[model samples]
Target chain A: MKTIFTRRFPASVKIIAIVVLSLLLVLSSDSLAPARQYLSTFFSPLQVIASAPLEALDNVSETVKSRETLMAENQKLRQLELSISDRLLKLEHLEQENSRLRAMLGSPVVTTQRKLIARIQSVDTDPFRLQVVLNKGIKDDVFIGQPVVDEHGVVGQVVEVNEFSSRVLLIADNSHAIPLRNQRNDVRLIGLGRGDVHQMELQYVTKNTDVKIGDMLVTSGLGDRFPEGYPVASVTGIENRGNEIYSTIRIRPIAQLDRIRYVLLLWPELATSDASAPEVLSQ
Target chain B: MRRSPFFTFLIIWLSILCAALLQILPLPPLVDEYFRPQWMLLTAMYWALALPNRFGIGSAWIAGLILDVLWGTTLGFNGVMFGLCAAFMVENNHKLRTYSVWHQSLILLGLVLVYQMLFGTLSSWLDDALVTNSYYASSFITLLAWPWIFFTLRKVRRRLFLS
Candidate 1:
C-alpha cells in the first residue's frame, strides 16, 4: 500500500493544512449560521426518531403509576386548584379596578399575551451547554427569543427555531444572562449562569448591595428577551470578600432545568415584527 | 481474499451509522455528561486501522462531518479532529496492527487524550470560555471502551468479509 506521506508533501504539511482549514472554518462559523439552521431542518426528524424509545419509556412509566398514588396526586391538585381559583377571583376584581383607574388616567389598556404549550423533545447532552429541544417550532409559531417558562418560573429562551423543533437555551447555560431585580428591594442585577444546571451568579453587584440570602430574583424586562416579573432564581449564597470589588452572589434557578418535561412559550405583544429581526441579524 | 466492493462499502456505512446512533442515545444526564464515549472517533479509528486504503482520512472526515451536525457544533470541529486521528491511524496502521490488544489500548488512550484536548481547546477558543475539566472524563471513558469497540468491529469485519 502507498504511504500517506510522500516525499513531496510530508505529514507535517498535511497536518498544517488541516489546522489552517479548521481555523478558517471556526472564524467563518458566524457566516455559516444560516447553513447550520438549514441543516437542522434535516436533523429535526432524526432527533424525533432517536428520542422515540425514550418517549416510549416515559409513557410506560406513566402508565405504570399506581392508582393510589394517582388518587393522592389528584386530591392534592384539586385542593391547589381550589386555592388558585380563590386567588383568581380576587385578581379578577383587582384587574378590573386597575383597568378602570388606567381608563380614568387615559392610558392604553393592557393586552393579554398569548401562550403555547411545548413538550421537551430532548435535552442536549453537552456538559458545557445547557439546552433542550422543544417539540414546537416554526409551524407552531415559535420564534427565536421567545420566553419559555414552566409551572414554577422562567425556563429559558428559544434560541434556534427549525420547522418542527426549536432549541431553547436554558438559564443554566454559561453564555446565558438575564437582567433581574430583587423582588424584595428592587435592586437590579444581572444573573449569569455558571455552566451548571443548579446555580447562577449575580454580576456587577457591589459588596454593599442590599442582597440577602433567599431573596427572590425576577426578570426586570430590561433586555426585552424575557418578560418582566417572572421568577428566575433565588439568592442562595453571598460572599463578601474584604478586598474584592464585587460580592459573589449565587442563586438557585427556580425552574427545574433537569426535570423539565413541558414549557410554556410566551408570545410577546410585538412578536410578529420582532420575530423576523433575529433571522435577519443572524444572516 | 478479495471482497466485493459493494459489500465492503455497505459494512463501512452501516458501522458508522450504528456509531452515530450510539453517540446520540439518550442516557441519564450525569452519565451522559461524564461517560459518553467518542463512538464516531472510535469507529473511524477502527476503519483506518483495519482497512486503511478503503477507509482512510476522507472517510473519517465525512464521519466527523456527520457527528458535527448531530452534536450541533461548529461545522468543521469534529471533522478536523477525526481527520487528524484517522491520518495518525493510517500512517501507523501496520505497527498498530502488529501490537497486542493491551498495547493498542494504551496507544488509543493517548490518542483519545489528544483528541479530547484538541476538541476542548477549539471549542473553548470559539466560545471564549475556560475549558472545564469534565471534558477530560470523556477521554478516559473512551479509553476504557476502546478495547471492546476495536474487538467488536474486528469481529464484524471478519464475519462480513472473509479477509
Candidate 2:
C-alpha cells in the first residue's frame, strides 16, 4: 500500500478513480446541500457582476421604446387595470359569500397565501435542467418547496435556498410535476413537464375524461407542494389512442417559463398553523 | 517555463475566472438555448493541451466543480466529465499538439460530443431531465471556436513567458 501510494497512477487508473469518486458524490447529493448553499451564497455577488451588462441592456431597450408603442401599451394596461378592478370588487363579494357559506357548512376558512417578489438573477444555461437563480433566499424567508409564480401564472418551485440566493426548478423541467385539475370540469390530473419551454404533459387522464383543447388547468393542491387554484397550464393537444388506457394530453404552461424576469414566492399560511390543529379541523 | 510560479498560477486562474463569467452571462433566449458554447470546457481543454503537466486531471476537476456550483448541477457531475476529458487530452497531448488546427478541431468535436453524451445521459438518468438534440449543437460551435481560443491563449502565453 505504501509503495502504491508513492507510485504515480496511470492516466486510465486516475480517470477510473475520478469516475468512482464522482459517482459516490452523486449518490450522496443530499449531504452536499450545505456546501451547495454556501457556494451559492459565495457566487451570488459574482452573478450580480456578470448579469450587470444584461440588466443595463434591458433597461436601455425599455427606455428607448417609441412613443407610439409606449402610448399603446399604456392604453392597453389602463384598460386591463380597469377590468381587473371591476373583477376585484366582484371577487371580494364572492369571497365574503364563500366564507359565509363555509361558516354555515362548518368548513375551515381559506387562508391567503403570503408572497415575496424576487428578481431572476440568472438562468441555468444547461439545456437539460430548466432552472433559474433568484435574488432572494433564506435571509428573506425563502425556503425549499415554495411555489413560485409570475404575473401570468405558476412559474415553478424553489428547490435550493441559501443566504441570499435560491434556485427555482421551472415547471417546464422534465423532472417537475404538479397536481392539476381542469378549471372547467374540476377533473384532477398530474401535469408533468416535457423538457420543452412551451409544453407539459398531463399523465394518466383516461380517454373518456372531459378534457379538451384550451381547457385551463390549475393546481389542485392535492400534493400540498403548491397552493390550490393557481393557474398552471392549458391543454393544447390530446392524443387518445384506441388501444391505450390513458390519453396523452399536452399542455402549454400559462407562465412564460423561458421569459420570466421576476417571480413571486408563495408561503402557504395554513401549512404552519394547521400542523398543531386537529386533523378534522384542519381539513 | 521560465515564468515565476505565482505568475503562471495567476494567469491560469484568471483565464478560468473569465471563462466562468462568460459561461453565466445572459444572452437572448434563442441564442442562449441553442448557441451558448461550453466556455469552461474549452478553457480547460486549451490549458490541458498547452501545459499537460501543469493543468491535468486535477485542474479539470476544479474547473468542473466551479461550473457545477455556478450552474446548480449535482456537485460532481461536471467534475467526472471534465476529469475524463482532461485525462484523455493529457494522455495524448504530444500527438494532439502535432496535429493541424482543423484536425485538432475535429478531435475537439469528438471530445465535446463524448462530454455532452456523458453529461446528458447521467443527468437524464439521475435528475430525470430530458436532453434534446439541440443540446448537442453547441459541440459544433465549440469546435468552430477552438482555433480562436487556441491562437489567443497561445499569444498570451508567448508574450508572458517567451518574451
Candidate 3:
C-alpha cells in the first residue's frame, strides 16, 4: 500500500480529482451569493475608471461634430416648424371642439403617468447578455422591473438595483418577453427576445392569423410591467403556412437599442381608495 | 528565498485585474460577437507554462471565479475551464518549455482554441445556444495575439525573476 502510494497516480485520476475538488470548493463557498452582488457593485468603479477616457473623447469630438450636424438639422427643422405651426393651429381648433363634445358626453380626461429621467452611465460589457447599467438606482426610487424608455420608444426594464446603479435588461435579451397587440387588427401576441439587438419574435400567433408586414405592435399591459399603448415593434415579416401550427413573425424594435444616452424609468402608480375614487391615477 | 510567495500572489492578482480590464474595454462592432479574448486564461496559461512552481490549478480556479462574476456569468463556469486549462498546461510544461518559440506559438494557439471551445460549449449548454462561431474566429484572433503577449510576459518574467 505504501509503495503504491509512493508511485505516481495516473494523470486521468489527477484530472478527475481536480475537477471534483474545484466543484467542492465552489459549493463550499457559501458566501458567493452576496459576493456576486458585491463584486458587480465594487467593480463598477473600475468600469467608470476605464470609461472615463472614452467619455472624455466623446465629449471633445461631439462638440466639433455636432456643429455640422446641428446646422443641417436646424435647416430641416425650420421647414418642419413652418408645416407644424399650421397643423398646430388646426389641432387647437379641433381640440376645442372635441372638448365641448366631451363635456356634453360627460367623459373624463385621461392623464399619463409621470416619468423619472435617468442617464446611461455605461453598458454591460458582456456580449451574450443584453443589459445596461443606469446612473440612477434604488437611492433615486428606482425599483426592479420598472419599464424604461427613450425618445423613440420602449427600451427595456430594470432587473437589478444596487444602491447607486441599476441594471436594465434590454428587450433583446433572451429572458424577457413583452405582451403586445397588433394595432391594425388588435390581435394579441407575446414578443420574445431573440438575442439580437434589432429583432424580436412574436410567439403564439397561429398560422391563420392576419398579421402582416408593417403592422405596428404595442404593449398590451397584461402584466402591468409595461404601460399599455407604447409602440414596441413593427412587424417586418410574417411567414404562415398551412402545415405549420405557428407563424414566424419578425419585428424590428421601435427603440434605438444601441444609441441612447438618457432614458426614463417608469414606475406605475397603484391607486388606493377608501370608499370611492377617480377612474385613474397618474404618479 | 529568491521569490517571496506573497509578492508572486500579488502579481498574479494584478495580472487577473489587467485581464478583467481588457475584457471590459469597448470593442468594435464587427469583431465584438466573435472574439472574446480569454485574458485570464491566457495569463494563467502563461504562468503555468513558464513558472509552474509559482501558480497552479488553484490559482486558475480563483481567477475563473473572479471572471465569472465580472462577466455576469453562471458560477463555476469559467472556474472549471480555467482549472482544467491550468492543470493541462502544468502537466505539459516540461515538453512545452522544450519547444522553440515558433512551435510554442502553434501549441499555444491550440490551447486557446481548446479553452474557447470549453467556454462556448459550457455557455451554450447553460443558456441554450447563446454562443456561436465555435471559436474559429476567436482562435484566429488569439493566434494573432500570442507572439506579442508571449514576448512581453516573458520579458517581464525574466526581469522580475531571473535578474
Residue B118 alpha-carbon offset, candidate 3, angstroms = 2.6
Better of 1 and 2 by lDDT: 2
Instruction: List the candidate 3 regions with Cα displacement exceeding 4 Å.
Output: A1-33, A65-114, A121-124, A271-283, B33-36
The best candidate by TM-score is 2
lDDT, candidate 3, at A171: 90
Error of 1 at A20 (Å): 3.5
Model 2: how far residue B45 lies from native, Å: 1.2
Model 1 agreement with the true structure over A1-283: per-residue lDDT tens digits: 2343333555566667766776777789878766767777876666787788999998999999999999999999999999998997897676567656766777634222577788888634344557788888788778888899998999999878778888888888888899998999999999998778799899989988999999999988787778777899999999988999999999999999989998888865532212221111110
For model 1, report DockQ.
0.44
Ranking of all predicted structures according to DockQ, beginning with the best and ending with the worst: 2, 1, 3
Candidate 1 residue pairs in clash (backbone atoms < 3 Å)? none
Q: Which stretches of candidate 2 lie over 4 Å from their true place?
A: A1-9, A66-75, A100-110, A122-124, A271-283
- Which of 2 and 3 is the better model by lDDT? 2
Q: Higher-DockQ candidate among 1 and 2?
A: 2
Model 3, A80: alpha-carbon shift in Å?
A: 8.9
Give the candidate number with the greatest DockQ. 2
- Model 1 DockQ class: acceptable
Q: lDDT for every model?
A: 0.79, 0.83, 0.72
Query: Interface RMSD for each candidate model?
Result: 3.1, 4.2, 5.6
The chain B TM-scores of all candidates, as shown, are: 0.93, 0.95, 0.88
Whole-model alpha-carbon lDDT for candidate 1? 0.79
